[model samples]
Target: MDTTVANTGTEGKTWGGGNQPLKSSYGKMMMWFFIVSDALTFSGFLAAYGFSRFKFIGSWPIADEVFTHVPFFHGNYPMIYVAFMTFVLIMSSVTMVLAVDAGHHMKKTKVTWYMFLTIIGGLIFVGSQAWEWGTFIKGEYGAVQTNGGNILQFGKYETVDGNAVFKRVAVSDIAIDAHGERVEHERKNGLWFVDESALPAYTVDEVYNGLKANSDVLVRTQIINDEGEKTVLSREESLNQIKNNGKLVVQGANLQVNEYGTSLFADFFFFITGFHGFHVFSGVVINIIIFFNVILGTYERRGSYEMVEKVGLYWHFVDLVWVFVFTFFYLV
Candidate 1:
């Protein structure tokens, strides 16, 4: 008996494998799947961050205080630079959509230019994020790490128009070096070939002496009160705390210690933002690849610009993720 595959009348129908589900190409459908899975992953990360922040609500670092730096300007402008980065990323997404539209119209020149601008915007955003991370790691106003692993900041309460304004005092401004030669332990000089990290800008003794010299400045605890501000101690309490409890001068943030209130804040900030930045960088690279293809007339030869559309989906997803990150990390 001879047997051969025969298409019945229903062969051209949905159940007969002739239908394209969701009217999407195989590549586009796969891209959507990946985006969905990745979105869930990011959601989980943000959820974990939210739970962690809630757990340490009182000691959590204020986003406004922490991310208050621009590229060249050196004043306290809270969330301004982050807002700029967000704008750049969103504009890049807009350009990406325009490129996709140009591809649909088979406008090779327009696609090339738009894709180029998208790539540039992504690069600028990535560079801005890198600078922000560098500034975060190299903290502004140094704080003291207590023996119990608490971060104690220095600020003075001033009355302006009958209202109290807290003025932050930098450790560098107030710290005076006493007569001592403090040497960092280096690998070359240590026993067992051990290596040691670089020393901080000032020693704890110097900070204590500075606090003693400045009667106006007081120690601020990480604990937040009902008013959502760090608890400020009295002058005598500040002196006693620094003199007895202060152990190290923490100048910046790291995996080990953060000058900011809680180390958890720094951990989540670095992890979530770094993950999002990596996605942006990856999208930039893919855009570059597609951009060269557009210049080479690859999609034109194929008679379809679905490649641009696929990558456009990815770029939009990245931009959307960033909006959520900005909301959770900066605004909230």
Candidate 2:
């Protein structure tokens, strides 16, 4: 039965042979409607993120610093790896479309090969996302402090060599327990797990002393020059001399984040990106099923590979969502 009809004598009509305006099998049409609604949901999230950016006014975490890491390297190179991952995802969408085209022509072998490529692309994307999450959860350069406990960033120097210097300070430079060890929960007794390796650098005494030496450093969350590059505050200006001066000592969750940075950003970043990644994963599974069905000649006997085309719609939509996620979450 030729279910497709061209220019039938009926106006404003699309039956199954002629789709009746917006009619298709319940599954296919419903998929489109569902996707449209979900897109709006994601847009809401992105918009809320933008609102937060405006609310912060002067202080906010710099995206470049937060998301920087080389794919495989000794030195901390950043951004290039995740950018490559974006390309990988877009290319996978292209492959999935090609598979759909092949299925339309009943070319079973072509469909199988392209579907395989699509699946591999999805796997690589998931791995890259995991790497990105790991890097974000861990911060860099540390922070500046005031007598009252407020933090300041060292973005460029008021006077370069006066007291502002970017050096790897140690946690011992900051705080030391009475036992001469930095205090933290015992990993063995922790309920789930904790990253002890990510312990802070520098001791309180070292930070205060460093602050005392640098008189010009300001104790705000982050520093912004005309160009907006973020710089860490000098040790002497921030911690050494600044204790007893009024500073915002944000702790726990609040301490975790602020206009300069926040733990909430990290937590939400991992959760949202992780959920979208899981969707790509499931899409790959559906692709594999379609791939084997083609190879096994199920479609050849069934006379149409519409199933492949259906799943292709889903795979491509997943790629589309990632594009938005990347732009809003990383770039902007």
On TM-score, the candidate that comes out on top is: 1
Question: Cα RMSD (Å) per model?
Answer: 5.8, 6.4
For 1-332, candidate 2 gives per-residue lDDT tens digits of 22222222333444433344454443456577778887887777667767776775455566765666676675655467778988999999999889878877878889888999999999999888877665544444455445533445433344355884433332223333334456555677684576454333454454455444544433434545566754444544444334645243222222254323644455556656777888888988888888888889887787766677678778878888888888877787
> Model 1 scores what on Cα lDDT?
0.88
Q: Which stretches of candidate 1 lie over 4 Å from their true place?
A: 1-19
lDDT of 2: 0.62
What ranges in model 2 sit over 4 Å off? 1-25, 74-78, 144-220, 223-226, 231-237, 240-260
Candidate 1 C-alpha lDDT tens digits along 146-207: 99999999999899899989989899999998765688888677785886788887888899
**How big is the positional error of residue 68 in model 2, measured in Å on the Cα after superposition?**
1.9
